[model samples]
Target: MSKHEILIVDDEPANLQKLKRTFLTDYTVHEAKTGDEALLILKERPVVAIVTDQRMPGMSGVNLLRQAREVRPDSIRIILTGFTEVEYLMDAINQGQVHRYITKPWEPVALKEALRQEIERWQLRKENERLSEELRLANEQLEKENFRLRQEIESLEPAGKQLVYESQEMRELMRLIDRVVPTNSTVLIQGETGTGKELLARYVHDQSPRADQPFIPVNCGAIPSELIESAFFGHKKGSFTGAIENRKGHFELAHQGTLYLDEIGEAPLDLQVKLLRVLQDAEIMPVGAQVAKKVDVRIIASTNRVLSREVEAGRFRQDLFFRLNVFAVFVPPLRTRRDDIVALSRYFLDRCRRRLNKPIPSFDPQTLALLRGFDWPGNVRELENEVERMVILSEPDQPIPASMVSERVRLASSTGGSDAGGLKEKVAEFERSLILEALRRHGHNRSHAADALGISRQTIIAKLKQYQLDDETAEG
Candidate 1:
């Protein structure tokens, strides 16, 4: 453990010096001649306590401490005042802005005792928070392990769902799929693009009894708006001008199997109504047909979009979303499951080598480091393409050089992904940092943060919830 840092701010030249000297023997003291300088220090580093004079040139002590609360929400704050007015100072204490206020001509021993007590309290509070977080994380990890073991995957090999992974996240996802694969319930798979949502959908179908049956995939967004209905349900020979003969629709083709609806959120409003009918009745009414034909197809929908928001926006039906979300699966982005990155890279390298008949032994260690260091915003697909490119550029019977990697990847590797995140959670930590920075830069306004991030107001609300952040932890 290291000594706690404390910040002292005062307009008087000798005052801040005296304050710094007093705490020099106890803590790491940071002296700021003005409130602005103190806030800059707070932003740059961590300080457990703030000691400031109540009077300043541009910003008063109460106001500065109030903003300091936003900068370092957990830091203890105390104010020194010599004036007769106590109304605003008391208000600051009441509002939790100032933890305590001391009068001028205070005894050094009394001030030191007060600061010690408050600092001890702050330390206790922080330790409690740290322990609570550790307990929460431990519980979550135990639950994950229990769930995976409960599925009995360790004793059995699932050849049907052969996803290449060595990550805990993937194992947990496989556990979820194992739980839902035995049933005929509809599944909705959601994730960022290139995160293998489609692959997960296939895993669900393969693990189920429907493995032997047809697996029909329909791109909801690729079909024309005028012919979407016709495409979904077979058209009669004379139904439309271009209808030459009858054809089996996806639902019919996938009878007794799985009908994958990729990008399901792109389905039009009218088509969504029809889809809901089919999901409810397991029947499809072909174009120019008076009777509905029964089909026994299991629906599996995949989307990169948020369907719940689409329902609220009236672009999607609530009933359809409810039906499709019976068994939900979220494919995490590749950057998250970095344990699989090296394995995937090697797998792709071998495949590419075999295809091209290249004698390249392997990727150089420096090259591998660059591959692992990138954020990979485009996810697995981007990585696969990059591996293929490197294979082409490598010399025969030699390890691939670091220079063979793309310039973009090289830049990302060199900067270590721009302090984006720590080792375990790059995406989340980076997102948290950006959100906090945006909040601070915009006067701790949530709306301003949302705008700065180019996301909707509701979206920012959801992000705040996802990160377990308090929306009201802002400066007034």
Candidate 2:
């Protein structure tokens, strides 16, 4: 059988025979005495190109190609007509019924060349479509693998724990995370406080090839500046007044694993230079030591502060920012993902109920609406606290009511921020005082205070920074 198929149509017997004989050496040629006959042959067999005569009985070449388009839209079409009848085929060309045409008494070589080119075009298009399908399937498989990795991480969490996401933006973010996970490249996660930046970092580490190794997480802002060097690098015995013996620092502890640097923007400038050196050389020089030890650790850093802004303000080193920002993911704040608020609220409530041994099981519609309407400046962390409080206070087996929601969320929803600035300032003032009281009640221990307030420790730390609460001097 010939490799390519071609159909030729004409009203005369001699013309049809000549055309068939011309292309028979290279193609499987089908012949028709009229346009109607050609279309009938096309319905029975697939052809790569169709060449038809313009003047025919019952149907014309243009009409046949137009109908043939519905049957084989991918076929290449050419019209055969006299030089004087070229005007008639112009309309066919304009309507997309024809690709090219040869006048009567055409050169056999020229016609053969044209048909060969059409066949090549068809083959190239089919190839492109095949490649596109392969790419689509590859992406689908990657998504599945990412999801399997995420579930593996989830298995490590307490029962009923899952990342609550309903927004398209968050779903896309998950896809991005899946693509970036297998690579050892450094990743920088930027988001507002309480937006789960660290969770994303953990996801990356868990999905990576280094999943079996330890995943060390360090809060750069929480570590005291005086001991930052010792905390990051090992300390030899008698290095300082408190150094009773040699100690392994974060780098040594995290060797062959992943090291997560949280609040990286808060690292002191002098420490940033040292951190940059370690990142560059994959080695650490411990305190009071002349020797630098090599390390094999992947770095994944996160910061709520915009490091670019910090760099501009001369607070963060530009070199360190570039090293950590090889790949970046931004976690959307809860306010922008309001659709997930109700789901997250339910999830947190379930966890709180199990922990506190409470019987409250759900939230009434009014309470759900109240939760969704709030701006949630503290994002998921604050929402969890509110739901926990509601679960603790509501009666057993009862749905949480709007009354259980804090006044800040309730009043903001009711007023619609008619006086946005004044209302926001007043709200900030109330939040600062509330946080202060919680801290005081917990003996100034941020962790205990964070647990009591139902917010993340990072959120509490961020608030303290906003209110200028000195950790060393704050009484409560």
Candidate 3:
């Protein structure tokens, strides 16, 4: 609501003074004696309108306006010319550089009117731009809320599938999913690869009213970036070179069902924006089609990467992350759920043997111990594969022994057992070195050494006793 500022440039002091007096009552007038000085004023202030005399020293009025165009292209420009040259007028009109032109010996009233008109025009343009930016932000907010409400409606319905789990970690995960299933909220399932994110997504789908519908799972990482748009939102025939037939996209095919976007963090940035728009508006325009089609699918996205970190690193969009992270469920890795290791191993073993027509006994105590101790970085999938491998290779009568376990598992077990013993030895050695150094620096004064190291004399004596450092010191 501040008054609009105007800049007046003229080599003549009388012209500059006369022009300033005309607009003194209307605007905050800034005067410049030369075109170069006027440009400096334009850079320093938000002068919406500029009026310059055509015959100026060094730079002409049209040239000044042209340079001003480079600095503040939005500012309205006017030129004051005494001679009516066709070429000068053509330069002003052709380049579309000057907004208005006035002749010398002009009436004060007419010049005032032109300045007033240009100022009003500049103000109107600024208001339009401001409103446009506001509208864009408002539309984005509305779409976000619209997407949220759509999910909430689906979530209120009853569930379809119940998950199976014995470990506290997975039980907690299921309980979290139970609360999330009835709402139309978007769910982001995060975990390491092979942590059963897809299984969990299926569980959520089965538990929800949408369980009766299809549960389409798309691995975003596996899809080629170029085909991502067509894969998510179908395309028209001849949309591109390879578009031979009409295809319903994943969103359309999964209508009224669940769209499981797995490995979602790997999706291309360009696709991420499109995906965000789809979530916001619940609609997608097919490639080569002018109209967008509506879709009704519950969104449950999964990713192995830390999406919040991805946002910080500029790899993922924050707005898209917010839309997809309305609800979150984290699948526990196999190593953290130790209780399930033996049970999962046995289940996979029995199922593998039944299929292969081989009867294998349960693992022996040593093998079971090894399995429990080895950290399963590959999670449930790795355990299942290993069990299947052992079943296919092992003798039917012999119980699965520790030797049957893979070298990595055996190495992990051996390393796991020695970690504590080796760490204690390393700590004692470090402590001995520190105490010796501190004593040597303090001239072997136990009290001074304790003070230097920020410990009590008694504590240092206890350390000396524990490491038997006193005997070595006595020999020295």
Candidate 4:
């Protein structure tokens, strides 16, 4: 540590020498012959402690200590007063906040002990202040990071699972996803089969800062329980049944990149515990491994099941559910975003034609009407398949017919009901019905349905909110 300066004010030379010998080992001694000289030394240097004689020529020791208080509130003050200067001792206590009072011919050990205690108190106060400042800075940084993460999550909403829709809902989802892709927070995507949850996860990873690194997608449900650990945390050679060679786990492979765990809800309870530990600690221990390996991987988990319900039912870990739910992107189904059905159908139709090396064809008005009427349970995935089928069957220059759509979808659209209600009321009802139906179909792929429509994904999201559709129904 650096040396502390101690100012000694006394007109007598012998007294100054005595004070110097006492504290010379612990502090640098500055001798001031008078109170005025003591004040001058204090002005030029940072003194940690002050020792002064009561009787001085121009100024008294008490007055000097009082003035020093204004310059350095933290400095320890000591008054060396004789029996005759009892009044000065009282004055020093009240005015200078004197830390300790010493009398003439004081014992050497006692004087040293008093100075040591005061110095220790001063050091403790400084340390406490330093810690408080550090804590304040840390909290401020955390708040900023949280806000930025929220914004990034919001931006990703627009682009998420919206490739199938032509509605405003698709736009909204895209916007939210865009905002969230820049941060380091984990993302949770919830959608049904064929809703393109993996596709959206890839989109997020592609748009993130870690885009240049690997984007490893793992189907948690597809992996066998016995091999899950090896797949996730890697295994040493000869450690497992198939361990002819060492293998890097998903976490290691995705270092400085993203690890997309699809169907996370289906992970076994035992594996869930291991996954939680990795997320919490950023380190993983491979199967039969003695030590944990550190990895820097961004996790993006997806599921078609209701995780909260799964947690409540004891099928999934509550802590793990909360951790993954930090940021959720729900993909809507196809039927809910009916407004984009026509547009999406046309886009898919054109795409299919190009892929098949066939001329682009238009859909007849009846075919458009038939598509709008169908309640798509399979969401965008179903829609794309249907379009591909139509492209293959239809002639190069022929317009697609209403009969080309599945008989069930065609019957529902054509014979559902009359369209005589007021436009606003009818539109509102249509939106509500679509949202609910999409949620039921494709297991509520909000992102998929939103994309199928030509609108922003947020719009379909708002409808879900306005309609008060539960996740089970909206996503089912």
Choose the strongest candidate by TM-score: 2
Q: Mind giving the per-residue lDDT tens digits that candidate 2 earns over 1-476?
A: 54788899888898888888879999988888977777788899988899888888889888899998888899999988889888888888888888888897887888999888988888999999999899867864664455456657766654433577878889999999899899889999999999988878878887799886667889998888889899999799899999998777888777777889999988888889989999999999888888999999999999998889999999998888889889988998998987688668878887888778887756655577667778999999999889888887798877787789999988877676555445445446556766787678778888877765556688789889998877774442
Against the true structure, whose lDDT is highest? 2
lDDT tens per residue, model 4, 1-476 = 88988888889998889888988998898999987788788889999999888788888878788888888778899888788877657765876468778888788789989888888998999899999899867864654455446546644543223355566777788788887899989899997776778878878987889876777788888888877888899899889677987677888777777899989999999889999999999999877789989999999999999999998899999999988988898887667777778778787777777668887457654566667767777877787888888878877777777668778776676566666434344445665665566556556777776654433578778877787776654541
Q: Report the Cα lDDT for residue 178, model 1.
A: 89
Against the correct fold, how does model 2 do in TM-score?
Answer: 0.55
Q: On residues 304-356, what C-alpha lDDT tens digit does candidate 3 reach at each position?
A: 99999999999999999999988987888889998788668777776777778
Give me the displacement of residue 85 in model 4, in angstroms: 85
Give the poorly placed runs of model 1, Cα more than 4 Å off. Answer: 1-162, 417-476
Per-model lDDT: 0.81, 0.83, 0.81, 0.78
Q: What is the lDDT of residue 252 in candidate 3?
A: 79
Q: What is the lDDT of residue 389 in candidate 3?
A: 83
Give candidate 2's whole-model lDDT.
0.83
Off by over 4 Å in 2: 1-161, 417-476
How much is 312 displaced in model 3, in angstroms?
0.6
Better of 2 and 3 by lDDT: 2
Once superposed on the true structure, which residue ranges of model 3 sit more than 4 Å away at CA? Answer: 1-164, 418-476
Instruction: Please write out the lDDT profile of model 1 over residues 314-394, one tens digit for every residue.
Output: 888899899898989888888888877766777778778877889777765456666777878888779889999999988
